[model samples]
Target chain A: MNDYHNRRGFLKKSAITTLASLVGTKIMFAENIPARVTPLPLLSDSVDGKDPEMTVLSDRPMNMEAPAHLLDDPVTPINKMFIRNNGLPPVKESIDRSAWTLTIDGESVKQKRTYTISELKQRFKPHTYQLVLECGGNGRSGYYPPASGNQWSQGAVHCAAWTGIRLKDILADVGLKDNAVYIGYYGKDIHLSRDAKKVVISRGVPIKKALEDETLIAWAVNGDDIPLFHGAPLRLVIGGWPASVSGKWLHTISVRNIVHDGPKMGGSSYRVPVIPVQPGEKVEETEENFRIIESMPVKSLITHPKSGAVLSSNRSLSVRGHAWAGDLEVTEVNVSIDYGCTWQKANLSAPKNRLAWQQWSAKIDFPQNGYYEIWVKATDSKGVSQPMVMPQWNPKGYLNNACHRIAVKVVV
Target chain B: MNVRRVTLAVAAFFVIAMGITCVSDLRNDQTTTDTTATTSLVDTLNYDPHSGLVVDTTLGLVVANCSGCHSTELIRKSRFTRDGWIAKIRWMQKEQNLWDLGKNEKSILDYLEKYYSPSSLDARAQMRREPLDDIQWYDYQ
Candidate 1:
């Protein structure tokens, strides 16, 4: 045991020395301090049959994310989709597909209307679109001086074919009053405390976004009825915006005359800086300094040659990834093999759906690489490209679209 | 200056090596007894099987009150000041169906503040990457 400790200590010291020499810094060691507190076992591990690859940030009010490498599919599988919930999910026993009702009301509605799940399917034309739904804090772990929410290291996003009625069609049929400005949504999921007054989550988008052709009151994902965790029977799927705006276990839609200030919509909850701030600088959460995040920026992820992957030196490597822009189409994707010193265009596949992510792949010859990094950058139809570094610092760490970097080693 | 620094570093390393040896000898003598006591203490805590939440006697009340509705993970994940925890509790009582703690509120606040206080700015900054040193140029043959 003593020898084991000595050997481990010597190895750690040697590693520090090498790192210090490479970075040209004097490394100091602290005694008795554990290098890191043991991270808790993922909550998914305890579940009967959950995806083992997911990083579980919390168990109750369950939040788990699939690692970026596991999310390489063009359409994210239902079982692999990330889960983010503000409150406890409704019990399985309480779910009654036939009895589910969606109530539409508010001062802005000329006449309050309620529709059952069956009625919604019978009354409206069903449209299907492949849409992306991403959490506002998708890449929050990359933020310096880490933010307060789940430290999602990307992969808090998924694109799936949604089968539902257009939200605009519902708004038109219900007859929106002239005063209606914002569309608020409510869900059946309750707070863990069973507090009668506390709402788990209630959020919405502006009337214009609510009326978009792509916005939907979805009943199905990936050609199947939405799973319970992803919101079963019925849920709102507002593409292009943060998934929070697309309330799950959806039951109510309220047309308000003012911007909805429901839970998770107030203060700087889902808001980002209006103008870029210095990295790691603190800024007060004020209305003028920040705005409610909308329309995500163009982003790409390198799925192949995942960070720390080993490749053969002699073989030509085929790098592949996925790219998407919120609401807008991704026009170009470029890969950098030499730390952005030079860029090579990658072939982008046509998206299967209007709002779906496009797959891109490129082949490159490694020039006897010791260590190599592949960077992927994407641009939207609006000509907005992802920044090389994080855009700005925000209190809650929302809307991070920094270019993705993947490190790989080539072995002879 | 470089030579002097190297010599000092070597001397300091030897001193640390000697110190560790002395400590290791003492630790080995007590290892068996210490391991048993630690195992018993850990067992007594009766950590939540699902969430791995440590619920010692000091925090047993919190586990009992909070875990009935939500997993202990929610409470463990949150880091807040005394006021922040109070505000959250009040918010839960007002909005969510959390019942008033009544007299136990102060104890809850004290426990939460002790265990889950907001990390200081310096502590957070220490987690940031140090600025990269200037690159030394090398000639490739």
Candidate 2:
């Protein structure tokens, strides 16, 4: 009798569990989350190796721009340099220095040649130059009709000392054909899709720009191995142009007879409208209507005392900053405390090298205690000066070299 | 045999009564299984608090389509017109290999235009700082 009761109880519980499970499964599985969720910002120090102050724009293909104040150092430290990655950096284990090699080949090469990093180092003389690299969209936030991409503020520029062999030396060794018009570079960075065939980004400069003495196939910055975030094993450092022209994780460079038609070379990638358009005007862009941006415009940043600095009326305020013109030198930098009513010239210093940024300083005394804005404008070797307002609007919002202003409060 | 049959019938009735009681206990945690019920489960159930995306009917579709390539922060920080959004979509499709939205394009565009389009706060007249007449200066040693 007991055995019969036990069997009957077991059957009843099993039936109930089955009914409950059917109801519960519907509730639990109702939300369908896709497999490829957005990447979370999960950079531990070891992974990114960037200062905590750097603002991250993207994580998957990590891009971070430095803050204006932290960039006060005359020579930008490796930690403070901005990182712009177009694709996933080669895996740490795969970046074996011994196995790394750079190949020079394309339609315009007399003969294709490959060189190991050690061989290149031994064969060619090493040179160092402090070059200023500014992103084309450095002041993009100033645009009224917002631009797309990494909404960089004023910190995408850095002047760092890079030690490497001159790219011109390598081109000379490779014996470029007379027809070589442009040189496009290839990197080892993996595409986001992990597709082996697709290139993330491959941009190049004209052969004339490539042959400049300052253009370097750099392996180190500030006397140290290039930070992994800034493309350590090897990179091309073409200063004074858009930093993108300086490809990172560089593995191969191709000399092309025609303008190199790489992934980002065509379209309006780095090109501005040949005829300037009004803000918010849409144009059907074509080759004739747009031109590739070469030298970036004049720009300045006030890095001393920082914005929101508090000052005493009795003491004279000392201000300092760094300024750069794309391919020209900063001839003058003026600071205005009382709006643009009057301008006071600051003491300016020459660049350490040809394409390096110049430093400027000034001392000012306040008559009364209140809030004031210190605006700094830089003029390049050419008569061109930074505009007080946003410059001509472009579709991609490149080169918004408006005067940088900082707020200060004075106490009596 | 007759006695055994009688016992089986009585046991079956008792077991059915117990099963109904067990089902009632299981239902205490759930409000209702009906999906169409008017009570908004969006705040409590359907929302992702991390991205702070406006929870609407089309949010799941947006996340599935857009978040796969970039963080929702990129979407959140950007303000654009309907045309601008369309241009970006076209650019991505052309350059970044974004798959065609197909039949779902209208809904996605509608959601983006409603939430992501630029507003009057963008006017430079409003964003400019007020002239520094009113002053309360802090004492700095």
Candidate 3:
């Protein structure tokens, strides 16, 4: 709760109020990327070269009524990864690789320097850690009446083996300045304001999050180059934070005395309530204010046999899926077959780092599987666990961590 | 200037500024303009040459189908593949009362693929392909 309390004029902050006046004109959100290798399927099911275990939702909806679970591997394969973009997917062309650079120039670093993706890979010892990346709006649609933006269902999080140079590795080289209190990042997503002004969205991570070893300046995913739909070339990988602020197609890193107050940070998006409002209520700034969204809650989901999966035998089955608490270590995971009536602690096998999600496995035998429900709850080392029900909703629809339940059928 | 004169001047200035700002904002508000800033974003967000980002036939089809009711930003921010868009189109037609255009959906999708495919580059660049390590500027340039 530190550094929060800045909701001075919280009231009168409706999206419609802002929508009426609209900020920066709609110059172009981007110059735009053309599609290629087309004349094919509508939804991109081509997760070529990806492992099927980790990516059940990449090609299709998580079989909503069926049971789905996470893979036990630490690193997420490019093809098995889940994507939750708020808009259209951008195409990456080979010619577009004009060797862009990343400059570390925040208040913390001394004698800032630029490094190419290759230079970064070679200059610093390549570090690989398995972690979970979840969208800030993951499970937001469950907000009742739909809180607006992205309208994401459940498929927004992914656990992956992220390989890259550690933020500490780069910061040590840059030499932190004494006055540096925060680290600000700017990505390459460009959108024009209605005022004909070009706006580049910039976000900031507190110095605490930036200095963690698990936080990486990643350029590769799953041993190969990262894919474009994913943050390619290079991106900021915050071990346990909201996905939107991670800034895909990342460009600049600046250390500052205070928070990055660009539209992306202060005025435009990622704002949520510092405290939870009751469930089924719209967060009216006039009544309750919202703050910047940060770390994700401890969460988990079932990935095996699919919800509503009909297994022939009544034997016990292996239950697997990813469990994580952004930046925090998941100490224990609990599963409930009767929808939270009784819970069984799951076995959590964490990967290399504390910040990343742990691949969990558990076993349960169903006596009768007629429209059965399976729910998973995770608790962090900090003693935080996913709640059984949501308190309420906010303007941006953030931090949705109700029990993740899957339904599967049993056939003899 | 007197108090009233100064007040009038300030109000006049605000009005004039809003007018000029309004006209340009109106155009961009409706559509994303193709320019250096946007291209730079394309270049930065992308890993490869980003030649696919250039406006082409695929873009036209996308504009016709996806943007029929909403702005391109609605389609642009989505990170799904061809199939993802199709699911959305199907949802729009079935769930939200969008009419099926027989087969125009394919063309619109093809165009979107060309203009909006996600870039799949390495988390880090190859060593041999490393650009100069000297302190260059951020592509923020």
Name the best candidate (by DockQ).
1
Backbone clashes (count) for model 2 = 0
lDDT of 3 at B14: 49
* lDDT by residue (tens digit), candidate 2, B108-127: 88877755666422443243
The 10-residue segment of model 2 chain A with minimum total lDDT is: A1-10
Please give the lDDT score at residue A356 for candidate 2: 97
Instruction: State residue B13's C-alpha deviation in candidate 2, in Å.
Output: 66
lDDT of model 2 at residue B137? Answer: 29
Instruction: Give the TM-score of each candidate.
Output: 0.76, 0.81, 0.62
In candidate 3, position A257 carries an lDDT of 76
Tell me the tens digit of each residue's lDDT in model 2 across A1-412: 0111111111123333443453343222211111111111123334444554566665655767776788999999877888777778888788888889999999998899999999999989999999999988887766767777677878998999999999999999999888999999999888876778889889989999999999999999999887776776899999999998998888999999988888878778788899989876776778888888899999899998667667764656888999999989999999999888999999999999999999999997776888788899999998899988778888888988989887788765
Question: What TM-score does each model's chain B reach against the true chain B?
Answer: 0.51, 0.55, 0.45
Q: Write the per-residue lDDT of candidate 1 for residues A1-412, one digit (tens) a residue.
A: 1111121122244444454564356544423212111112212333333454565666677888876777888888886788998887787678898999999998899999999999999999999988889899998866665466776767898988899999889889999888988988989897877765677889999998898888999999989988888887789998778989989999999999998978888767898777777664556777788788888889998887546566653546788989999889999999987877899999998888777889999997777857677789999998899887765678787888888877666775
Best of the two (2, 3) by lDDT: 2
Off by over 4 Å in 1: A1-50, A275-289, B1-70, B74-141
Error (Å) of candidate 3 at residue A320 is 1.7
Question: Model 2: residues >4 Å from true position, as ranges?
Answer: A1-47, A313-315, B1-47, B125-141
Among these predicted structures, which one has the highest TM-score? 2
* Candidate 2 docking classification: incorrect
Give one digit per residue, the lDDT tens place, for model 3 in A130-180.
767777777654554334455454556776777788887888898887787
Which candidate would rank higher by DockQ, 1 or 3?
A: 1
> What's candidate 2's DockQ score?
0.07
